[model samples]
Target: MVNFTHQDQGTSASCWQQAGLEQIAALDPEKLFHAMASVIVLAAHPDDETLGAGGLIRMALGQGTDVHVIVCSFGEASHPDSTTHSAAQLAALRHAELAEAMDMLRAQGPRSGTLHLHCLGLDDGKLAAQQEPIRAALEQHAGERCLIASTYRGDGHPDHEILGLLAADCALAHNACHLEFPIWFWHWAQPDRQPSFRHWFRLALDASSTDAKARALEAHRSQTTPLSALPGDEVLLSEGFLQHFSRGAEIFRATWPGHRDAASAPAVFDELYGEREDPWEYRSSRYERRKQQILLACLPQERYAAVLELGCSIGVQSAELARRSTRLLAVDASATALAQARRAVAGMDHVELLQATVPRQFPQLEPGSLQLVVLSEMGYFLAADELEQVLAASAAALQAGGELVVCHWLHPIEGWPLDGEEVHRMAGQLGWERIVEHREADFLLEILRKPAGAHG
Candidate 1:
């Protein structure tokens, strides 16, 4: 069962006080102090700002730092208490709810303050309709030096995904920093399938901040009850945000754009998503089977000095990797999944479990010491350019002629920056020489060798 910080002692408005216990482990003092400067929260709706970054905003305000909120919509059509209400009425109530939420967030104890709130007045669900204006708002406010926080595409919310894309564009246009926080869409996006390392910001809310967060979330009483009702929902003891730094020029990925054909990517989900006792059973069932097949096909039947597998969800693949490598580092973002992985691979002496995200450069890892880097079912989560950085970082992590593997699920995701095929094409652009390419009925796997003479 998923563990969450439960807040039964207080009203629903104060539930957020318990939201961060899991997230606090990810934060350190250095990261918290870094976030004290300018902070920006880009929300698809008013409640989102509170849901995702309320603790961080409160921290910024407490430190007398600048904090800005950009709300894409007034959430005119969202109201959990009024099923019989019309859209117009719902909009009115949501707007009022947002005003109250903002007050609770910025105001002391029970009063609202004059914190800056920017609203685009876009249609709540039809965020794509207001893309132009949304883009402009993000670009205008995302000046250099500001730390911006937005939603991740995996949240399974359309508006939130668009906001993520818009935030990426703003980061590119103004060269600012940006992060993605998971929110309500966690209802549908499976826990094991979500991106682990993409969130760059790691923040912890203290006990007092937790109290303020609960009160701030409680202020949106109409929204919280329903959100908390979603499957596996739990109030957190602490809350935080995640960030993925940009690699180069911002790469915009849209199915609507005629970028490149993603026809060649693998569709792993279609083959494995059957009714199972554990929703994440595929990690052990079909996922493990396929990963074994890919490892056997790509890796030599010999031992290696070192190997790194980023986003190694359940160590299904990492176990097989352990047999072929001397030392293996497996990292994921979910502590629960990592715990399960630790148990699954407990007997393997050469494996290490870590909590981290992809598109992240593990500079501390022994550079030029690793022989192989495997990224499976993890590439599609990032924007196009970010994938390139992951490849570069993998190259840096490896010695000359080191091996790098690329694998991603091919089925169409609603708002991914690029499909699996586009990610592979970008990998080809890197200096690595292609070694083996496997095309099966379900997935695509490619192995590339770093040049011995040229630096990766």
Candidate 2:
């Protein structure tokens, strides 16, 4: 099990002080609950839902709104040092604790009989590998005009982060509002240093609701106190940790509206290719042909050691890029596009094609290893925050003085959240030196060099 108790007491104290230095804006509970058709809570562990949003859940239920709770794990590995109990025994105890916690929450609400609960029973500490199954389960329960709540992605836990990403995707797919609550973030994150992209609001709880939340938290006996009589066993939820949650209100942040869903861009291309093999006419258009030549000619070096071509649809650009690169790895999200790309580049031994979704399943390149990267006609497919992540990844993988070339259409597509200019504007903010910028009536092309000694 991961040892969260090892966190330095001094640093935790500093974080707690910073957390309360500035008060977060208040969110009106009546306005929030009245607008939601339903609510879905995704908890990475047994007590996460209670620790983060217990009061919010009570208010929603008391208002007679339908609510669904999905607990992803039974938290079997939390007390790995215990000598009196096996992992199975700990898991069984955690399950019972969760049931009791839910009963305590429901007892405080008016419509206590209507809340639905699901225990996935997934193994603790391994949720990152099981994203697909968890995502499918969340999608089944999510619906339009609903509110989805999950732990914040930056909550300092692996399971919580992955589930937060999955919850954002599900919320976007169902057109629901996504709210993220902070759990461990309060123990480490400094309030003033939070990222500019994050917006936060606190759900104010009255004295009665605060007391109810405290009682609900007390139901998880295994976490709040010592779990076993073994010599090494200790309380997982220390007094320092519980102090962060003792406030009268709980803090919630927004995620999906600013971050694009992983499936949204891929789904658009999938449907477009379903109708025709070449949706953008990369093979036959004179404009595309000239654009490709301009992109190739703008390279600073005559030849690159290795190159990555993101969104290499049908290998049209990959075939030309392969000649200039000793080794080329081309990637796209659509399997249909990759099938054609595989056939198109079959004769080239130096080229490799892989199907991967961006900002999620990127190539694991060694730090500062890649010599060049090409992003062509694909930036608009991502949201502002998603594009930022891709840019950061590219910066991390690029060698010192490595080149990044971007070619995007000037106009906006009907369903895309970002336009070509917006994508280029965000890239400009990454502090890379602009080496070459070519503008045309139809498209915009730019080449940026990674500054020497810079890291992503």
Candidate 3:
């Protein structure tokens, strides 16, 4: 269990005692809620990740949990009114600062390994255009299981909110366990007032955890102005991160679906992948061939008792799989594709349609539910590391003797993980034996089997 001690900082401790506020307790070590895998922190900018859950991260890493970070935006719009630096320069500076901060966070002593950092180069506040890149990254890192941390919707900043929503989308798309931390939510947790009484759950920070958190926050020297540079007496003493431990009096609700005032999905190819006679021509045609490859990789075989396809695009392969599988779970990231899949598979009761993404909308398949898992052409468009999440969830849901199929174009794409070969090779290392390896001149196909008696 986490241990805590109130700091004898004179007035600070006294004020809290007088106001009837107690020190938050450290996280319970025995809680089943504790995840035993790597922790992935998704942030819109540099400091947000550390500020929101630095203490928790420090504790997790110190406890030997591998830490992976994915910063979606590049912080180009930060402090936009500053006259001393250009937008590009500010972005570069912030990036450098984050690099230093990451080094510091990793410097914490772990029993075995160090933290891993992945900084995706997406536009600071423009996430819509970068969806493909983000998805690609997530697909690359889809693991057996993951503990993800990100901001909440009420975190005050628009970019933060968008990141939170996107992170949730990625979580659903990948079907991983997730936890959200809300930074800059101080406005919601003010003293018990009238109708605005904010709801919050508190966790006390132990001495060691608190010290680590302070050190991590201090790593961001670029953000602290000269006046805010004092050590323990710094002006930003509260750590600037809050979390919703309990729902409390807060009313949790989701916005209605299909109420979009704007087109959220992008225009992409809608056709059977890898079926074109001129395979090379299609493969070389920018994203056209890659799209086919992703779909094909995600849907390997027509034979299975139960199959779940997440982010099924345009019913391209869904229509084909509908003919082969006894029952299929066809999911889509785009409403456009879902609508199309609905029409394409309308007469078929074998396929259950769902509009959801990973880590968040994991299809609640029963244990030993699936015979095969396919990633197809969808893995490259996510944030790379998140792909581990999808893979982990798939592993849990897959039965013994099941096969995992992956197919992706070998063509080079900028700002994504290594090509299809690299992806398969990594997958091979994750306890699955590669049973079938198909290498076409244009794409790579791999069928990996879950070793017998592996799912105990």
Candidate 4:
């Protein structure tokens, strides 16, 4: 069973408060604080840094770690109805407020000149449009190894979600630890509805750090206090809302290092398919062409009654698998990739292509139904635990003497969570009798089978 902080909490507190507190108790602050030499905080707007992770910034600086903040937007549109300030004036005011907040946070630490701030100055409410520039800015400033804290992707704001994704990407690219701080998610999202993969943890703030956070939040008067008397021009951050951040601990969540499930996988293929149908040269690469031929030739049976191919990107291999199977289920996480696959296999009625994420979205097959299961060049996409789930599900679906073929690249991918060798080793430990093992300079192909007399 999946262990969630919210599920184990036995408290009379509201669901939100219990969930927040549960996450807060999960991590040891003393260890997490000293593990990093540098910290980078990515904020969608001026006040987000302070509201979401001001205490964390204070704690990091006090521990003598260098802290850098990158603000993605000036938040001019946050108060669009302000009678006292125009958008330009509002942007300038938020900029000044951010500097003041940084100053307050810096004052809590012993080191001078340790806190640095960079304002991307992108248009407010349009950071999504400037993803490339924002990503470039993050890449330029990111240190070799640092702790990156950004807004949670599920923070219910477009700018916050986009910046969070870019920050995660930059962190993964640089091999840094990435943390997500929620601003609006705490206010609106139900605890049970949060993504399962997020490893929730909390950073406890001492009195001094808490005081510094309060001062930092006070710096953003434009948000906390009302600017105009007009009924429509409301205070963006109310006292009740600010109370959530003023607690003794701040809530945070981290993504799986190097490997992400469907929820957190970088939108690489989804965006790549938008530009061109074949991004990785799936259809025309000599290397891929040979691998596909070898894969088909090594299948144990001449024809499979039922076959399932996981991560069948663009259905290049799916087209071939369709010819060998009475019915084939080809599934991939990217709908864009599946759309192209549909076109490639337009005339194949036996091949069914679906956009589904695995382990979670895996189709339920009756016991002893499927004769062949193919996991090609896709095992590295799952983490260790998810791979086990896939292995168990596949084992349960396979018929007597069924073949499970796994082919993966031997080389390690920089940001992928699992390597091909690790995936193959786990498959070997599943009590299946090894049938064929093919080793190449660049890849490894292994075929395993259930004993013919084994019960389903």
Best lDDT among the predictions, by candidate number: 2
| Residues 287-351, model 1: lDDT tens digits | 64765676566775377889888767667777878888899999765555666678768999889
Q: Per-residue lDDT tens digits of candidate 2, residues 322-377? A: 88989999999888888889888888999989888786577888988899999888
Off by over 4 Å in 2: 1-32, 62-64, 103-114, 120-141, 151-173, 180-215, 229-232, 238-260, 264-268
Between candidates 3 and 4, which one is better according to lDDT? 4
TM-score of each: 0.47, 0.80, 0.44, 0.64
Report the error of model 3 at residue 348, Å: 33
Evaluated against the true structure, the overall lDDT of model 2 is 0.80
Give the alpha carbon lDDT tens digit for every residue of 1-456 in model 3: 012211212123233234443333223532412545666777877777776766556666767777777887767665554556567876787788787777666544427335777788788767755777766666566455565667764455666666666655555544454455654443333322111111223445556656655566676655553222344323222322222211111111111111110112222222222243332344246656555554554544546788877666656567777776898888766555567668778899888888765644567778788887767765654433345546666777889888787877788754343467666665675678777677777777777888777742
Q: Give per-residue lDDT, candidate 4, residue 72.
A: 84
Comparing 3 and 4 by TM-score, which wins?
Answer: 4
- Superposed Cα RMSD, model 3: 17.6
Estimate, for each residue in 1-456, the C-alpha lDDT of model 4 and write its tens digit. Answer: 122221222223255566545443465666876677788899989989998889888888877888889998899997655777889988999999999998888854246328889999998888889898788777777876578899976576778878776887877677678888877766654454443323367777888789888898899998888887885467887766677787777777675445554444427568768898787788889999998899999887889989999989988999899999999999888888998889878988988887776765678789889999999888888755457767777887899889899999999775667788998998887778888889998999999998776634
Off by over 4 Å in 3: 1-34, 107-110, 173-175, 188-201, 226-456
lDDT of 1 at 77: 55
Clashes of each: 24, 0, 51, 2
Residue pairs with backbone atoms closer than 3 Å in model 2 (clashes): none
